[model samples]
Target: MKHLFSLLTILFLLSCASKAQNSSKEKKTYKVEKTNAEWKELLSPMAYYVLREAGTERPFTSDLNKNYKKGIYVCAACKTPLYKSEHKYDSGSGWPSFDRAVKGNVELDVDYKIGYARTELKCNTCGGHLGHSFDDGPKTTGKRHCINGVALEFIPKEK
Candidate 1:
């Protein structure tokens, strides 16, 4: 019937428009650049794996999960300050959960590694894979930045 044909055409056009919108999202660029060899030499095995290879660390395995000190967490790769201790919290997800990150220090992108869309978080300066951010978080930001321990280094506050 012509009605059925017209409905199908409308659906097809809507799908195409949705795809175009998704693809138009901005991409992030980093300032620091290095070859794989250079990164490997500068980072530890676990840090390199999580930061460069987009690998996840075993939950509750990082000492940072238990750390409750006044400090700032920096990228293990480029030492860029990403999150502050005040924003860190226990999400019971086995990773270091932060309510937020320092503005302009982290970048977000979509990842489909697990057959689903996830907000992938990366260090803006080094372009290293930090982890993912979720909508389920505290009232402060309502954003949970789940970061890998191996991908971060805590710098104690200078008293």
Candidate 2:
């Protein structure tokens, strides 16, 4: 009985830890940092939900999901260029999908929000949660960088 009790306690703690990690903002130091109030003012409610709270927008709700143009995608909070137009693709995931990120401009962390580990992507400059990455993707890099449109600001390429 003693061993069983200890085991149950450990499992409970582990589950709680994962939940906290999923809901909380990353703790790592970012180059661009701002208080919650500052971030709230600079970002829209939806943007703040997706970027700071690590929330997801409803599928098929983003205008950028079907956008096909020449441009670069930058972090909404900080204008850090993340994905180039050439790398963007239609993964049918309802959110903006990119084959890869601009090298070192985005960061990846493990997320266990749904009881499974998913690769959570973040803006390297400001540490804003962008989205998750999956292994299923085009042959180029075999990386599906599933991103939230609200977390990105598209900048049209200068013609």
Candidate 3:
């Protein structure tokens, strides 16, 4: 009976491991799908780097950081509206900071690229890398979405 119990435990462990592996192998699908070549051609060099390759732009380099006009910020790659001007605020992070994104427009994922777990935010529509979200933010939302400016385009609110 003891030997049988041990064998059953081992089999259960193996089964659990197998399920974990399968889940990891599953890839996330996005609404706006595009070929790599198409993305490269459609976005500017820096935009492509940030959105497609998950690269970061230099701090304080994006004009959108200081933009205060009423507008909607859209994904530069797919034209999906991500954030509103009303949510934009200066977090002194030298990047465009927003307290929240448009509902259901941004998705969060875990990333360990920087040697620690970070809340990585992506455009839900295109799966484009937008930026990392942090907990240090104003009391309103307590979410600091530190986005790459190149990953977004501002559409000024029309009168």
For model 2, residues 34-137, the per-residue Cα lDDT tens digits are: 99999999999999999999999998998899998999999999999999989999999999999999999999998999999999999999999999999999
Residue 79 of model 1 has an lDDT of 93
Best model per TM-score: 3
Q: Worst ten-residue run, lDDT, model 3?
A: 19-28
Local distance difference test values of all predictions, in order: 0.94, 0.95, 0.94
TM-score sort, best first: 3, 2, 1
Q: Which stretches of model 2 miss by more than 4 angstroms?
A: 1-26
Q: After superposing candidate 3 on the true structure, give the runs of residues whose Cα lies further than 4 Å from its correct spot.
A: 1-17
- lDDT per residue for candidate 1 within 111-144, as digits (tens), equals 9999999999999998999999999999998999
Clashes of 3: 0
**Candidate closer to the true structure by TM-score (higher is better), 2 or 3:** 3
TM-scores of the candidates in the order shown: 0.82, 0.83, 0.89
Greater TM-score among 1 and 3 belongs to 3
After superposition on all C-alphas, the RMSD of every candidate to the true structure, in Å, is: 5.3, 6.6, 2.4
C-alpha-based local distance difference test score of model 3: 0.94
Winning candidate number (lDDT):
2
lDDT of 3 by residue, 1-159 (tens): 999999999999999999998888567899999999999989999999999888899999999999999999999999999999999999999899999999999999888888999999999999999999999999999999999999999999999
Tell how far residue 103 is off in model 1, in angstroms: 0.3
lDDT of 1 at 119: 98
